[model samples]
Target: MKNRAILIILSLLLFIIVTPSQAQTYQTGSYQTGVGIRMGNTGGISVKHFMDGRHAVEGILSARWGGIGVTGLMEWHKEAFRTEGLNFYYGFGGHLYLGRYQRYRRNYYYESRGAIGIDGILGLEYHLPRAPITGSLDWKPAINLIGRTGYHEGGLALTVRYTF
Candidate 1:
């Protein structure tokens, strides 16, 4: 458990340090809606819909702490490092974490717990220009404000979707 957390933290740091910030390239989202799956510490069903070329809203429903968590985010997307089909995005949102069991493990406890929190997302996405597919790798962090209060360094996630 500790190893996984360490690895995740290191990976995030590496990406942040390495991503080039030169005036490279970017493209507006070509697809309007993408529905897919997310795999990570909070893996679940994911859906993203673009309101325009650069703005999008994403929703995630996942199982966490023996309960359910729903997250909604509003994001802005831009081209990344002159790479075609590659985009960099960042966003913020809120989440609801609901648990209904006495779960105690690894310095964590959630007994019928429900909390509200805010979240931030950072990542890169690649859309296939010739296919209706898209993939993204992102890091999400959250802080609970209502129930379980803490700064959660959200895990790294890979999301794949069918775009339309």
Candidate 2:
């Protein structure tokens, strides 16, 4: 199942990479919103909405360990190099997570009922020209302030969004 899932994700990435078109994207100030899937250690559905040319907010909803996680973010976008449809973004946000079992790398485990954390995100995004689609690779590191207090770093993800 895991291999099949990875294959599907890779195929989607290839599809996004091959097709290019012209469109006003997030950095160009003409795009309004994007909604898609977030694939990562903690992932589900993701939605991003631009407030202006460079500022945007994103929300993610995911289920894990018999519970749910909700995250919100405020981000800034800037053109990367002279590449059309390519941009770099960074942001900070917060999350509320609920779980039944949490693992530790040191060979221990515990049950975590809930927690709140601050999250930071850095990513590169590409808007497919002529297609209402965009793809991004990101790292979102987070530190829990309430429950299961610690830092998490393996938050790398690939997001494919359909924009309007």
Candidate 1 C-alpha error for residue 32, in Å? 0.6
Best by lDDT: 1
Per-residue alpha-carbon lDDT of candidate 1 for residues 1-164, written as tens digits (9 for 90 to 100): 64576466557646754666443344455798999999998689999998877789999999976789999999878788777789888877999988865757799875657889988788999999889999999999887788877678887999999999
lDDT of 2 by residue, 56-155 (tens): 9999998977899999999877777768778877777899988766677567666678889987777899998888999999988777889877777646
Model 1 pairs whose backbones collide: 25-82, 26-79
- Off by more than 4 A, model 1: 1-26, 101-112
> For candidate 2, what is the lDDT?
0.80
| 10 residues in a row with least lDDT, candidate 2 | 21-30
> After TM-score superposition, what is the CA distance of residue 138 in candidate 1 from its true location, in Å?
0.3
Cα-based lDDT for every prediction: 0.83, 0.80
Give lDDT: candidate 1, residue 21.
44
